[model samples]
Target chain A: MFQFKYPENFLRALGKPLVVFISRVGELSEFIARALYSCVTPPFYPRLLLKQIINIGFYSLPVVALTTLFAGMVIALQTHAGFSSYGAESAIATVVLISVTRELAPAFAGLMVAGRIGAAMAAEIGTMRVTEQIDALSTLSTDPYKYLVAPRLLAGVIVLPLLVVIGDIIGIFGGYLVAVYQLDFNPANYINATVNELQLIDITTGVIKAAVFGFVIALMGCYNGYKSKGGAQGVGEATTNAVVTSSILILILNYVITGLIFTE
Target chain B: MNQENNKIEVSELYKAFGRKRVLNGVNLSLKKGESLVVIGGSGTGKSVLIKCIQGLIEPDKGSIKIDGFETVGTPRKDCEKYYATMGMLFQGGALFDSLSVWENVAFGLIENQKMPKKQAKEKAIEVLRQVGLGADVADLSPSEISGGMQKRVGLARAIATKPEVIFFDEPTTGLDPIMADVINDLIISSVKKLGAAALTITHDMASARKIADKIAMLYQGKIIWQGTVEEMDKSDNPYVRQFISGSAKGPIKVEI
Candidate 1:
């Protein structure tokens, strides 16, 4: 095996990508640190911050609403089917309430906003980067991190929890409509069961998860966009990367946040 | 040559991306209120040189003294005071698509100097008119405007702050010759009106001839020659002659 053999390019190829990936992670960490520092610095842009809140929160409502609503209804139907096999249909209300508040609402909202808002942020900032608008911002004596990244991070961290709260209510309502109207459960009794089992921890944990997810989405979008180069193709790649990375991060973080907060 | 008389003095500048050096020992000085134009072939690091001075691209080695204060390797916050008195007109206009045209023009005034919105709007309109744009165009988004008009708006934004020094990056590249001339005239007038020292980088020979009071030719990361436009016409250096003459045959080789 040791007989005068040159190593193939296989290790070189694999090592190159590995090194690039590690460097990319390090760059992203530095970018996030700068963004967070800009967030706390003075000369805050209230106009830009308000605009992003409306963008990330208000504009994202219909999509998040529709996603969570359908999610709740689907879970309601599925739980009724499974529990009814044991004549335990009465447990459906508890299942719907706990699942919607503790998991489904926040996860769906995060994914929905990641797809809608994250991609848009990447495309917008990516275009600005290639077009020299970000450079233009700097020559005007405005810090690009403060002007572009901080408002977005602040808006995401502040607004996503509010969005998740809305999603939680609408999602529970969706489950309620299914249980009372279609499944022949008593409206008053189903409401009683859902409300009785709604622990404060479920809602609080979901909100906390929503904030973390929001930060991830904004960070991925801004970071990808900021580093974009070349032309329209580069911006297209950034948009795709923003959505894909943020969605994966949301799912992975969902498990971690759930395990950390819900465990004894 | 007096230090206090110069607005910007860049000495022994060197920059490289990986193994490919873009600038090597670039020595240039702009006296206050003087117009110096750098001309070079495309991809010859003309833009990179300007960016290095703007502090947008950090040069590997250089001393860039803006108003006699060293800027190279200085912390960004410390450089902000230097940048505040400077303005740049980007080649693409680089107008903020998010804001209306007037907002784009007034951005620096309102955001950096903290001017009141109403006052800034008035100032924006005034600057727009100075750039040969009508006040009606103020409310329109930059995307709605034509390229020539965007350049005007870019010029308007550049001068809006009454910056002491101005940098123009390819101010006339994408426009037709006639529109290019009009922009050249406007650039001359704007620089004159502001009494601002101007540094422009362009490959357009006609634009360089029209806008430059003094010209410098950059080739392969060095200023091969520098002199007045008349001196450029008489330059015996084959590189400068080949560039100004637009000849494919000479010491300069075309990759294509």
Candidate 2:
């Protein structure tokens, strides 16, 4: 074994990451369950949860809406140009409709929402941890998770789906506008075509996908924030992790969900 | 003494961070309405010890009896009932910036007690006044205040619910000596006024003598010396002498 020279130092460094990984897993698991538990638990902090719902969920709307709209337009243009050479231009409506609703809308919406609200949650709680308010809250007879993490996760899971569903609708409309007005498709026919082309399964699958992505974003955000240690640098790392992990998880999960749903 | 009625008991405690041990077989008692100051060098687990008792950092092995109810590994739900009796002034004032000073002070009362805002604000003003801040200052933001003022607000918030116990983490570390003494005097008087048990963590000896009825010097994860303030000057422990006098050349060498 090559453990003679650097043994102790290697063990110490290795222990931190292992503990960190385990701690993060515990935090995420607890938050997900507790958010569900607190729903039926008496003495619900409804006012506090409402405030968080507004802050983390509703406030992210304008950005998610705008980003989805623009993304939908770009996808439309890209599909139009590519399909033209293959003489498959007539199928552009179905292509844009499926891709935007099932994939782009949910994926980009999750990523954007994750980057915005996820970073803010991590930074806020991370700062609180470093500053010792989390400890202070404990001394004051409050559960920091119940008081802080629960509401945020509750709002994220409950609200992001609605936001993404709205985004899916808005994104499809964006494609329609580009298709009808600029791409020279008939306006009424474009609208009718989009509706006819999109099966209920496509729309339902996208909404379900958005819900899963929402869970991923909230889980990553709360986990990073709850386990945040050290000071400014640690908070920065948690915020960065919230964004990176949520985005990656959203992409990866999208593929899995798509395979399961579309294949069946 | 009637003050001893307010004491917390610790017994046969052992804690370690992996192979590097901290809190090796520690035991002590802090009396009611009495102030105990825990002083130690940097990295000596002074904060860790306090955190352990408060249930922030769980100890590997120990018994912490708060007013006689043992707190070792108590379920967090039950811990909330225990927490209702404690308050803390963090190393840096941890006032929530999103709220006004009064709101920060009223956080617990409103959230936990479900007290209405008007009643909480009225009570918050009373506590703020007790800490020497006027009612007019209660509306200002925590960031808008000076460091000393923030500490005062933090102190006010700690005593707001009138908890039976309070912990001060480095209350005087960042202040000028004059301000530090002011904080020390405020802490002493407020603890006396509330008749609350106080446990303050610091390496500041000057503040220790002024605020603590008992002094415990922690080093290498253990309370190496514990005595009444008067007895500390006569104690012959080399580590205690070196730590109290601020001498660089001693048994306690800086890692540098």
Model 1 agreement with the true structure over B41-124: per-residue lDDT tens digits: 888898998898889999999899999999998998998898888899999999999999999999999998899999999999
Model 1 stretches with alpha carbons more than 4 Å out: A1-14
* Candidate 1, residue B71: lDDT: 95
For each of the candidates, give the backbone clash count: 0, 4
Q: Which ten residues in a row have the lowest lDDT in candidate 2 chain A?
A: A1-10
Tens digit of per-residue lDDT, candidate 2, span A1-264: 335367786666677888787876886777678766755566566777788778766888898889889888888899899988998777777777888888888888888888898898889888888888888788777777677776776777677778877888888888888888889988787777788887887778878887787777777777787788888999999999999999999999999999999785
| TM-score for candidate 1 | 0.96
Among the numbered candidates, top lDDT falls to 1
Error of 2 at A250 (Å): 0.2
Instruction: Residues A56-137, candidate 1: write the lDDT tens digits.
Output: 9999999989988988888899999998999999888888888888899999999999999899999999999999999999
Candidate 1: C-alpha RMSD after superposition? 2.3
